[model samples]
Target chain A: MSDVYAARRGLLRDRCAAAGNAAALITRPANVRYLTGASPLGAVLLVGPSEDALFCAGAPTGEADEGRLDEHLRVTVLAGRGGDPAVAAADAASSVRADSLAVEEHHLTVARHRALRSVAPKVRLADLGTAVEQQRLVKDEGEIACLRIAAEIADQALGELLESILVGRTERHLALELERRLVDHGADGPAFPTSVGTGPHSGRSRHRPSDRRVEEGDFLSVCLGANYRGYRCEIGRTFVIGTTPADWQIELYDCVFTAQRAGREALLPGAAYREVDHAARSVLDSAGHAEALAPWTGHGVGLEIDEDPQLAPTAMGKLDACVPVTVEPGVHLPGRGGVRIDDTLVVRPEADGGPELLTITTKELLAL
Target chain B: MSDVYAARRGLLRDRCAAAGNAAALITRPANVRYLTGASPLGAVLLVGPSEDALFCAGAPTGEADEGRLDEHLRVTVLAGRGGDPAVAAADAASSVRADSLAVEEHHLTVARHRALRSVAPKVRLADLGTAVEQQRLVKDEGEIACLRIAAEIADQALGELLESILVGRTERHLALELERRLVDHGADGPAFPTSVGTGPHSGRSRHRPSDRRVEEGDFLSVCLGANYRGYRCEIGRTFVIGTTPADWQIELYDCVFTAQRAGREALLPGAAYREVDHAARSVLDSAGHAEALAPWTGHGVGLEIDEDPQLAPTAMGKLDACVPVTVEPGVHLPGRGGVRIDDTLVVRPEADGGPELLTITTKELLAL
Candidate 1:
């Protein structure tokens, strides 16, 4: 693991040097974790000309949630409270006589950036842009293993919920139960807030759980995932509440299931991100639900729930092998509830079997 | 409620005007929620010379957890996908002919700040500093009422957990169950991640729950809070897992209780923030636990779990009436568990009761 982290930092350093920067500071927690294997609270990683160092605000808590620190890198524990690790990183860069330093401008606040400039006035500050994120776009086998476990945990949690009596339970309670089950199955936590939408609330992306109870004829759409070792995977499914499903509910569920399956099947290496989105989106669009569709039909997920290579109409990118992405497509009617079917899959070349599905829960429209 | 939001915007506008800027852009979620009733996803509030407007990335979801959008403020939904709300806000400010626009430099990323500049080339961008946060230092009665309810919900959840069979349960399970109870007792959600530390993990501030099970002779420390409406409150308590606590446990519990009480008693109007911190910190410091103390003894709480007017040794500023703050003091021993006592209280005048305690959980050393 330490060797992997060191190799990641080495790649980042090469990228920084190619950009004419002697050193680079990574402050975004996810990016820091990607390069250092650990992201302590208020920690910053500096890939430098002399030596790579991880600067933390205080002593690391050695918490399990915060992954193990890379032993190959030098660790500096900054003394005093409320100290900005980025500023300390900048000062260290200056002390090392680095003429230029690159920072993640997208992550650092204006104030922090200004402070870094003030601390190291002689050093030219440059934007690292989304360099680290670009590097993280393709996952190694180790990262994919973590994502696979995360998906398995999510499947287990959702499967357990299906076995229990969900009728008469508020959306909030059901959401909470799913989250508890995720932890019970050895997840660090829910990748994101579990969205349990019942009745009119169903089919909405990222819907906050409410107090509305599940009813006999309502559409119950549940979207949840697990964070296993910092890798996140998402799975959403819609179901009918009672034994008999309404015609509209069945139609909506089928449409969404087809759309989601289309998106999942379209996850091929060398495929344009927008093309995959259109493959799923066109299914719903032709079904006359274009106006109600979410901006993106799918998105990349990793250490963060939402990552780059968004599968949207205007998104500019091509899918690559080993990239984990969630294909989710849904449509909601104003007063009537709707359906959403989502799955996490890894892009794979046709030669290696197309699109490895991580979440294997049956997407059949079940009438509970 | 609309009037309240309008008035808050008016206050911010006046402050921005006084700072020589005709308009201000609030990008921080909590600050946006404070000025505009609702904080939609990727929303930015623009307080302008002509009118206040909220720029959202897309149409508002109208989710209950986001609170109600203020009717008085004009809302603009960006038409395209991947649009930056802050840039849209800057464009709006430029169109209004506002020569200068102030932004929360502490919240806006350097990349975002640059984008705002690029979008509104003529408008001078200035740091709004902590004006909104300073204004939020003294909360209104309505905010305090919400905090009171939040505190009550947290207390209810903690009380319920105390009566449950905690032995042999993992810390993660205990924390999740408490969060479920918080939602069951009418909370938007947990104010922050619930912390349940057992054995050696006890008394640590913001300790992440792990898989450690409760032992008969272990110390159990739980810290949790509830988010009601937009306001948040916090409460923490430590207990012995089984009856017959050791003399060290009793001594540590009493010491922490005394420290927390002292800090609460010091929450009078016009008291310096550091003075209050000292009142609590001194007790622990005198007991030879100085090195193990957390950075701050307490902090103000409202829309966000941790807000302005931090009670720390080097903190500047004086406490004002109606400010809801938490006085939490704890000492974490390296090998053995320790005790932490936390409470949410509003600073008040001496004649009107020095402090109104919102978290009414008993401070007794309970052996569950």
Candidate 2:
């Protein structure tokens, strides 16, 4: 693990040197964790010409979720409270006599940038842009294993929820129960807030669970994920509440299931991101529910629930092997409810048997 | 409620005007929520010379937890995807012909600030500093009422947990059960992650619950909070797991209880923040436990779990009437367990019966 972290730092250093920077500062928590094994609260990683250092405001709490710190990298604990780790990293870069330091402009606030400049007047500050994010687009076998386990945990939670009686229960209670089940299955926590929408609220993305109770003949949609060791995975499914579904419910469910399958089948190495999105989106568009679609059909997932390589029309990128992404597409009819089917899969070449589905929960419309 | 939001925005406008800026941009979510009733995802509030407007990248989902948007303010939803609301707010400020725009430098990222500058080249970008936070230091009666209800909900959750069997249960499960109970009693969610520590993990502030199970003769410290209608309150207590507490456990619990009471008693109008912290620290320090103390004894709680007016040794501020804060002090001995006592209270004038304790849970040590 230490060697893996050191290798990641070495790659980031080489990228920084190519961009004419002697040192690069990473303040984004996920990015910091990707380069170094651990990311303490308010911690920053400075990959420099001389040596790499991890600056933290306080000592690491040794929590399992925070990951283990790399022993090869120097760790510095600030002496006082309320100190900015980014600024401390900048000062350390200056002390190492680095001519230029590249910082993640998308993560550091304007005030902290100013403070860094004031503290190290001789060190030139440059924007590192999304270089680190681009590097994290592809995952190694170790990271994919974590995501696989996370997806399995999410599946077990959703599977257990379906076996229970969901009718007459509030959306809030169902969501809480699923989260508890996830933790019971050994997940670090929910990757994102569990969404359980019933009746008119079903199929809406990221819907906050309300007090509305599940009713017969209503569409019930649940989207949940689990965070295992630091990797996150997502799975969403929509089902009917009663033993028999209405005609409109069956039609909407079949349409979404077909579109989702098209999106999943389009996942391949070297495929354009928008192409995969179009495979699913075109189905909904032909069905005349285009306006109700979310911005993207799917998005890359890893250390962060939402990452780069978004499968949107305007998204620019090509899929690479080992890139894990979600293919979620849904449509909500104003007062009648809707359907959504989502799954987490890793892109692979045809020779390797295509995209590996991490979340193995059944997508067929189930009447619970 | 709409009038309250308008009045808050009006106060912020006046502050900006006094600082020589005709327009101000609030990018911080909590500040935006404070100034305006609603804070949409990725939304920014622009308070200008002509009128106040909210810039949102997407349509508001009308979620109850997101609050209601003030009708008096104009809401402009961006026409396309991937557009930043802050940059749009800056462009709107420039269109209004404001000479300068004050932005929250502590919240806006450097990349976002640069984009704002590029979009509004004529308008000078000035730092808003912590003006909005300063305005939030003293909450109104309505906010206090919300906080009071939140405290009640937290107390209810903690009380229910005490009635359950605890021996041999994992800390993770106990924490999850407490959070589920909070929502069961009508909390939007937990204010922060519930902290449950057993044995060696007890009495540590912000301790991430692990798989450690409760055992007899062990000290079990649990801290949990509830967020009701956006207002948050916290409470913590430590208990002995067996029928009888050892001499050390009894001594530690008494010491922490006394320190917490001292801190609560010091919460009066015109009392210095550090003075309140010292009232608690002096007790533990005299008992030769200074090294085990956390940075601050307590802090204000409002829209955010942790707010301004931190009660720490280096903190500088005076308590004001209607200010809600927590008085939590704990000591953690490495191998042996310790104790912590925490409660939320609101400062009031001496003539008004001194500090009003919102979290009315009994602080007595209980052996379960």
Candidate 3:
């Protein structure tokens, strides 16, 4: 693991040197966690002149489940309370006599960037842009393993929930239960807040769990993921509440399942991100549900729940063999419920049997 | 409530106009929620010369807990998926013929700021520089009312947990249960992740919950809060898991209790922010525990859990009436557990009873 972290930092170092920067400061939490194994609160990774150092606002919690810092990297605990680690990293960069520092301009606020400049006036500031994120786009086998476990945890939790009585329970309670189950099955936590939308709220993307109880004829769309070793994966499934599904519910579920499958099938090495999105989106578009679709059909997931290579019409990129992405597509009609099917899969070559599905829970419309 | 949002926006508009800007764009979620009553995903508020408008990436979830936007504010749901609302808001400002626009530089990233500049090249961009945050410091009566309820909810949740059996339960489970109770009591959600530390993990500020189970003679420290109507409040308490606490445990708990009380009592209308922090920090400093204390004794709480008017040794400015802040002083003895006591209170004139304690949880150490 330490060697992996060191190799990752070395890659980042080469990228920085190629960009004319002697040092790079990583302030984004996920990026920091990627370069180093742990991301302490407000921690930043300064890679350059000296050995890469992880500057933290305070000591890491040292909780066993919350992974520790990679032993290969040096760690600096900020002495003063509420002091900015990014500024401390900048001072460290100056101390190392680095001629220039590259930072994630997209992550740093103008105020923070100005403070960093004030601390190291002689060190020329440059934008690191999405270099770290781009590096994270293609997951190593180790990262993919973590995502695989995260998906299994989510699948297990959802499977357990289906066995229990969900009727009369509020959407909030059900969501909370699934989260607890995720932890029970060994997850750091839910990668993102679990969404459980029932009745009129089902199929809505990123719907905040409400107090609405599940009704007999209603559709229930649940989207949840687990974070295992800092890697995240997502899965969504819509089910009918009664012993038999309503005609509209079945039709909507089948439509979404087909769209989601199309998206997944399109996830091949070198496929354009927008092409994958279009494959899924075209299904819904032909079904006359274009107006109610979410912006992106799906997106890459890794250290962060939502990462690079967004599968949207405007997204620009080509899929890599090892890139893990979620293919989720859904439609929501105002005042009436809809359906959504989502899965996390790693793009692979056709020779390797297309995309490898990490989340393997049955997508067939089920009546609960 | 709509009038209150309108009035808040009007005040911000006045501030921007005073700074020689014809329009102001609010991109910070809390600030947007403060001025528009609802902060939809990727939403930005544009206080334009033509009319104030709220631009959102997608339709607001309309969740029961997520309050609706102010009726007086026009809401523009972006037709394109994943469109940057800040950029769209800038375009709207330019369309209104505003010669200058002020934005929250402290919140907007350099990349997003550049995007705004690109979209509205003719419009002069000026830093709003914490203007909304300053206005939010001394909250309105209604805001305080919401905070009061939030505190009550947290108190209720903590009080119930005390009655339940604690021995042998993991910190993670206890934390999860408390969060469930918070939502069950009608909170929007937990204000932040609940912190539950046991034995050696106890007393450290912001200790992430672990798998450590409750044991005899172990110090158990729990910190949690509730989010009600967009207002957040925090309360923390440490208790002995067995019938008797060690002599050292009692001493540490008592010292922290006294320090927290001193900090709370020092929250007078005209008191300096550092003075309040000193009242708490000095107690621990004199107790030979100075080296192990957290940086800030307390911080203001509002739409966000952590906000302005930080009570720290180096924090500047004085307290004002109706300013809600948390005075949390804690110490963690490395190898052994420590103690932390926290509460949310509102500063008031001495004539009106100095500081009003929102969290009514008892400070006395109890054996469970």
Cα TM-score per model: 0.97, 0.97, 0.98
* lDDT of each residue in A147-190, candidate 3, tens digit only: 99999999999999999998899999999899989988989789
Q: Which ranges of candidate 2 are over 4 A from the true structure?
A: A64-67, A79-82, B64-67
Residues A1-368, model 1: lDDT tens digits: 77898898899999899999999999999999898888888899999975899898766764423457666778887744567889999999999999999999999999999899999999999999999999999999999999999999999999999999989999989999999999999999999999999999899888888888999989999999999988999999999988989888878888888888888888899899999999999999999998888889889999999999899999998999999999999998877888888999999999998999999999888888
**Would you list the clashing residue pairs of candidate 2?**
none
Model 2 Cα lDDT, one tens digit per residue, B128-212? 9999999998999999999999999999999999999999999999999999999999999999999999999999788888999
Model 1 residue runs over 4 Å out of place are: A62-67, A79-81, B63-67
Q: How close is candidate 2 to the true structure, as a TM-score?
A: 0.97
Give the true-contact fraction for every prediction, in order. Answer: 0.60, 0.57, 0.71
Give all candidates' CA lDDT scores.
0.90, 0.91, 0.90
Q: How do the residues B1-368 of candidate 3 rate in per-residue lDDT, one tens digit apiece?
A: 68888988888888888889999999999999888888877889998654799888888775313555666788888855567999999998888789999988899999999999999999999999899999999998999999999999999999999999999999999998999899989898999999999999999888888888999999999999999988999999999998988999999988999999899889998899999999999999999998998889999999999999999999899999999999999999987989999999999999997899999999889999
- lDDT of model 3 at position A232: 95
When sorted by DockQ, best at the front, the candidate numbers are 3, 1, 2
| Candidate 1, pairs of clashing residues | none
User: How much is B43 displaced in model 1, in angstroms?
Assistant: 0.9
Q: State each candidate's chain A TM-score.
A: 0.98, 0.98, 0.97
